[model samples]
Target chain A: MTGAPRRTIAIVGGGASGVILAAHLMKVSGGNVRASVIERDPRIGRGIAYSTELPEHRLNVAASRMSAFTEDPSHLLSWFRNKYPEARDEPGRFLQRREYGQYLADVFAAAAASASGSGGLVHIKAECASIVQVPGGLELRLSNGTSLASQIAILATGHDPGPHPDRGFASAGASVPPIDCDRRVVILGSGLSMIDAWLTLQARGHRGEIVAVSRRGLLPLPHGEHRNPIKLDRADIPFGTELSYFVRWFSDLIDEREAAGGDWRDVIDGIRPFNQQIWRDWPISAKRRFLSHAKAWWDVHRHRIAPDVHARAHEAIADGKLRLIAGKVSDIADRGNRTADLVVRLRRSGDRIALQDVSVLDCTGIIRDPATGSNPLISSLITAGMARTDPLRIGLDVTPDCAIVNFRGEPSDRLFAIGPLTRGTFFEIDAVPEIREQCQRLAVGLVG
Target chain B: MLTKKGKYGLKALVHLSRLPAGQLAFVGDIARANNIPKKFLDAILAELRNAGFVQSRKGKEGGYRLARSPSEIKVGHIVRVLDGPLAPIPCASRTRYEPCDDCDEATCQVRHMMLEVRHAIAEVLDNRSLAEMRDTTNDDLDLPQLQQA
Candidate 1:
């Protein structure tokens, strides 16, 4: 350890990633570090994903896969068994998002309790408005007119759910309440958020027809019992391969599996552990191609919903209550009577189809670029030249260790980022499994 | 979530659900009608039969038949038998209850949401019988269709 006083690390955003990072830091720091978590919300752990008021929004991943600690993979599962004894034998279950949030809060609480006498963990219920580099540390200015100086700062603000991308649709102002139950609705994205909106509407007793439109309009696949534990060694992956070649290779592999009566999921799941490596090995152009061409397809297959949820979604489609349209919404116009029509260009024919009397819901997931976002903290950092967006513009630029890369192309030693803020560098940073591993590594690096 | 087995099984069961009560449908015919591979459909039907959703007989004129009336069998029940549980998460599952290991069941935010998801799913799948979904044409809309490009 350094021959200095205890180092203070300020983590902005007390979400899942921040909580997990603090817990790991407490375990490894050995009273050498004091951690202060700055959050806008009153409570920590329930980020945007888990803080939903609706109960119908379930986690896409199963229970067994959502452990906050990679070392104790069964931490969540064991907790579940202890709480719900009946489910002790069933490991392949998905829990509620809030339950996961509570678990995180509990884990953080335990960690904080243990570190009470040491450097200790402090929770500051305030938003970090800006961070400035100072001598031997950084100063974090909070929204509550307070400031804190720390030896290191970790940006874990997570993703921002920005407004709708289509200016015309957003201007239509269809999101207002007293929603017409009979009006036709068009959702702009076919991801999990789209499904959430559909479920929300259903819960609200909406009998209207819904048309979910996306560039690909590919809905998420259903989660089924995984029979095969297919293991792929590094040699099996086409590392350093071009994007086109890798796609062909992967397609052929899926074809081979299907031919042998095996599910394609086995292959996708098998390669999950190695995605970061493959993604890292890919050339810049290859990564771009992947983001442009294969992202939608990969999303649907990789992010599967529970079987019953799948059934309900399919049933809605089957009943003609919901429709999946593969297209891009070109424009939306309000038609004077609180109704609007969207001009959608079909993906295949490029023919414009006018969807009539429909309200549009923006479910295109969270914003990727923090620089252009409404988040004051992110905007402040970008403006101060303390952080810069990656070339892809998907997220902030960060080194593999999550050190913030400045505009001068230098990685900051005292400043770091984790979670969704580092998506541009690590493609799979949003999910619990990936984030937990990243947090563990970052904690070790920071403490060491 | 519908597994390939569950989907194929549901399709076959729906096909049977549409048939005259007590009449049998051959595995080949069901597979051909639904675009499911014959071998795959055979295994799926075998599972459905083992779960007591269907009864099969061998030899000429022998085929598979629903064990009960189509209206009596809920899609949710079939899905649970073929797939596993209707609940998105284990803790919210009624038929297969399993507590998550990480949080307080009473205070977990995720369980509350999942419970609602399970209820929504159960409302749709459990309340609607196979007979009710038998005539729905949207079932095959996901199948590949020619599009003008």
Candidate 2:
């Protein structure tokens, strides 16, 4: 508790980013910073990722790495024990993401209640339609026809599953189109999103045939215990090299490590800290090459899921209820029928697999193009020339410190972004460990 | 086969074709808007500029704009500019023909078959203009998925 809080930071979404940032800001500023979390969704902490009611949907990361505070490593496990004492609280335990959501909301509440300074949390249940810079700060227009003023605005609007065409196809597809529990369902993209759909369907007692189609037919690897991240000097890395050369170097390193009685996971975990730096050092051409050629491979290796989830997917495959195809859905035809027809073109064999009279679920991926994403706030930011998509269209363009860059490539002072929205700038972000550290750093900067 | 470069070029052209006449768009904006690589798009736009498809200006407001009316530019023409010929084989190409090292010029079965393949591809592509491509919505593409069934 310090002097009277004069500044209020308006966080546009009440997801993990908004809550975590609010907590960090309060902690760093000694409760001298004020923030209002504006979330259109009813829940204050769930966001899109953690809103699931299904017990089967758990966090991909373990409890040990899911702490909200950088200073407290055991915070998540402690909170989990208090909230659900019957459940196991092992460090490696993967708790339900919904519980994590509850933990976040509770943390923010506790911080706000105990703060002696004017720092408090106010959750506004309205969508931020747009944000514009004012003379001294920023103005936010909400969907409820109300406006908000704050010293700074952070766009914490989390993952969008692309445009409206992708409606009913989000990975957390609870309210999707009606489909028989025993009918065939074809899911596009065999990545995390596909795994999510598989988990959701299995939770719903779905016993039908599920065909997963992807460019490479790759699945996410599972998490394990033995984590030995290697330390590397800056000079040792082939910084600013062509993508192929970097890939070759990494491949050789992996081979050498595996030959020396080590696991490939060690190599991936070893390079985790340097992933963003390596990406930053590359030229636009090299970055493009990585995205086009190595992104899928990298994604599977880096973003591993829970071991139980991996086992269930494989079990389904063994039971012949799930099918994996190394192909792409070239077209989805809806003849005003209940089921859409998908013509999947196999990549290797070049054979067309005609999936007839099956429900089509597009779990292709996250919102790659932020400018055209489903969120009106993002498009409004772009239209107002206050923000722009990154060169890759992966997310909103941001400076390394998470400042939103305008159309002319100028980073804003009062306007900022975090969470998955800043993925283009911080490639290794979106996970708890990375985002938590980022929030702490950003909170320090804002408070200072 | 349309290379990724060609797809990107088409996407860029489609984006440009949608812009109001004489209105300019920076290469970076176009690249981000259409999910195209910046350097690759820069090169493609330069080729398009040289082919009289787009015009570039200099200065702060400098960027690119469609030179000819989108309707005046055919899809086949842009593909040829960005991705060589529409024909499967060089010998079958009408504008940029080159003899294949293995195939005969006359009465070659492969060339004859490829000539028909080239004609079939050109018949559709040459008829469609950039304007048509621009007008084709994602929903319109969905219709063919049913027609082929």
Candidate 3:
């Protein structure tokens, strides 16, 4: 062990994906790699999703399937069992989001401790302001006025909290205090985040009527009893360049499954394993068509809610406590006294409905268009020509291995993007299972 | 969460639950009446029998019957026996309580929310016996309605 300098990798964003990559790197490299995780937040491991303290914000995926390591599928389950021996063995149970965050913290801590011999994992609690390619490697300008140079850098920044509505509502302003219970609340975009907002309101004992509006006004389907698992081969999917043919094939598959007394979820889950491959194979036009047409339908089915949560949501809808409207918010007017009036164009009729005196929460999922996002680092990278958006303007363009492609359309060997930032390259890369698998492979590739 | 096996098992049990006391129903009859595959129903009944929810008799009078009177058997027990647990998350299960790892049990909002769900489900499945469900005749177990007063 005379004098060889170990290769150092810098991970920006100490979120779930970032920590997972660090943990896997330490494990695979066996303390031979130097790792530094730079995060803006004081807490590492808890990303925007898992950082929530709200118990109502349960994991969308079941505990049995949420292991951090792909090799040890039951790692999380075992952790739960060891920690909470009395916790019942519910195969489909959705654990609290914070608990999962803690589990990740534990994993990171363990990996960091074991890798202490070889430079160890450095937890830099500072935001990376910009990343620039230097002669030997890359240098990261951190927000805390310190800079770090590494042989390689990874961007695991996760999702951006979408762009604000063009016409800002009064409640969208920073000065607006916590929403009062009696004030009518209107949530824009009916997706998982919208559901989280609803759950939050319900948990907070908000008594006002809640209205969630989206383009299609579709609520996620509730998770039912686990059915027989369906496996699909590449041949089973209508692999083609034509979007229409694929859509027809998918529709027929769902119909057949339903006719055969199988749930539509079986078909969706079966296709999930192949989503990225299919997305990669599609022509740009086909991809655009799917995004405009089928993305919403796919989202609601793919991201289902727990049955109990679904029952409460259904009850709320039935009781008129929650109203889901299929429409577009054409305009929002900020009235004085923390209230906003919104004009919603009904989807079916094209007629506009004026919703007066409501608090609007923008839960429109993630901001896919990186150019319009509020992240300074991402903006800086784009401006510096270090990173470029995909053709669809959804996310950063990268090769299959997630090496960020520069303005010149060449994949960078030293710069990598993981998690939601690489969504354009891997369609289903956001979830824990997908991200974990990607990190495992990425760690091996980096070290080897 | 009810598994497919649990759903099929419940459907078969409901068929048998509707039978008059001392009467027995064959797997084929239950399968045909419920639109469940015969082989599936057979396995479901075998599971029920093993779980002590039902008792089977062999020979010319071969069939299955609830171990206890249908009025005394709760849907929750059958579901728990077949489907695993009534909790959407394991932390909320009263019968099988395991504190979630890294969770603050006292303050966990998820567990708190799920506990309500577990109770809601138990209220319907545990409170309503097989006899009551069989007597309803509507076939659609109005669970959401059942939660209402």
Candidate 4:
């Protein structure tokens, strides 16, 4: 085993996923692997999800489950508490997402500096425009007008935001004009992004009316205290049924669990481990049914907000400052004067309401259609017959082992996917706990 | 955008429209008859109940029935409640109007064309009651678009 050739692994995206994967590869391969993280952002681990400088944006999950390594669940909590001693008292604190992003980058850097083959890891700050399969490895063309070779290239491209407007909208985590504080804000979607933007306004001392609208008008439930979530057995989950049957069964389970003195959060967290399995077991029809009929409800219940943020949001509502509308936005006519008229169709009363003179924020979150993930590199790959979208078009098509599937229906061992890009294959993989586990598993396989 | 929820809700409403006057049908029966998912129908029916299109009773003998006669309920209203509007774009709808940002509200040809389309659809749907929707044959209807939806 001495002096064996070092294997090169290229991760195209230096968000939390790529940073975590790089750290895991270094730890697993000892001194025999070289990994490169390609990203346009000079700041590592601050991908689209985490680059938010806003102090209000926080981790959706609790501190206990947010470790970089699945084996060491308490690493993040310990690190956070050590950094901010005030956090020692709050065991379930949902820290600012920026803090978590910084922690991951710190850990990744530390791992690289202390590794036996410390020089093997490199962070290349450039965009990976395209990749091609070479004879014995892979070749990645960068936007900086250069190319590099690697034995394995994993698309850690992070969360694809889909098609977005050039401007005229405020988004969560993004900095807006410093003094637009007193303007009425009309948020398009009432999901987590809406909360982030609202909180940012609050932090900036905004006192204008904020109206948030969505089709269902559902706000994410707040995270609650929990000990051990109730464990679910494989037999208990109704697999291989139509989504309707599964939904009904799950609804009944919720009732029963509540009646028996169990928190609904327990039921959700209990089924956490099996989400991917359940997603896989369902037929394509069932999958489509769930996406169309039940995804919103599942998202609200599964992805909850921090308790403090929840209380503040409600307080704003009670103060008559924040208004939530359950309806649809029909049109936004820009008056060409910074203010726009947002026409909304009310779902409850079939009424058309126009919200005028309001600054707009499209907080609808990720684009509903995964087919819109046709970025330059992904588009090039599809055009070159290298990779394709999954059947449901949620994300990249991948095998059970996370290998990318090409247009000819062949899984390429050297090309892989992780994080949100692999969501079609592993439905619950967007969160930190699941992504860490994916990185660990893939690192082991890559090292082997 | 006719979502699955809207499609299922429409089918369920149609199923209720065909029932004997004052007759109540269990959710399972509605699901089976219409081939709708029982779980999905459960939510759709609950929404319909809130909208006062259907009233559900609690007991084992109790079930769901239309809150009003099929003739009194407009298909357009049902679609508006479940989906949103008949207009392909929001700026074009009579019931839900908004202007596109890039085009002038008074002069956009696309919005005008879409307004005509909305009028054409509303003429059929708003005028046609749930009874009419149920009575109409599927032959002349452009149903493939609905299936794709």
Considering chain A alone, what is the TM-score of candidate 1? 0.93
Stretch of 10 with least lDDT, candidate 3 chain A: A168-177
Backbone clash total for model 3 is 7
Task: List pairs with backbone clashes in candidate 2.
Answer: none
lDDT of 1 at A287: 80
Comparing to the true complex, what docking class would candidate 3 get? incorrect
Which prediction has more favorable TM-score, 1 or 2?
2
Interface RMSD of each: 19.8, 20.7, 21.0, 18.8
Candidate 2 per-residue C-alpha lDDT over A1-448 given as tens digits, one digit per residue, 9 for 90 to 100: 3456568899888889888888888888766677888998877888877887778888888788889987899998888888887875677888887888899889878767766456677889998888878888888888999999998999888788543363344443423455689989988778887887788887788888999989999999997665676544332354444566578778877887789788888788888877887787565667788888899999899989898889989998998989999987787787443468779899999999899888777777774687767788898889989999999888999999899999999999899999899988887788878888888999899885
lDDT of 3 by residue, A1-448 (tens): 3355688999999989999999899888866689999987777899788877878888989988888999998998888888789877677689988888888888888888998877689899998999988999999998889899999999999887544536443212111137899989988878888888888888789999999999999998887688454665442343323466567667877887789789888888878877887787565666788888988998999888888888999899999999999999898788855468999999999999999988777777774688767788998999989899999888999999889999999999999999999988888887988999999989989885
TM-score for candidate 4, please give it.
0.72
Structure candidate 4, residue pairs in collision: none
| Tens digit of per-residue lDDT, candidate 2, span B22-109 | 9999999999998888999999988777655788999998999987678767787677667765867777763345787875688699
What are the lDDT figures for the candidates, one per model? Answer: 0.80, 0.80, 0.81, 0.79
RMSD of 1: 20.9
What DockQ do you compute for every candidate structure? 0.01, 0.01, 0.01, 0.01
Q: Return whichever of 1 and 4 wins on lDDT.
A: 1
TM-score of chain A considered alone, across all candidate predictions = 0.93, 0.95, 0.95, 0.93
Ranking by lDDT: 3, 2, 1, 4
Clashing pairs for predicted structure model 3, backbone only: A55-B109, A55-B110, A86-B97, A86-B98, A87-B97, A87-B98, A225-B2
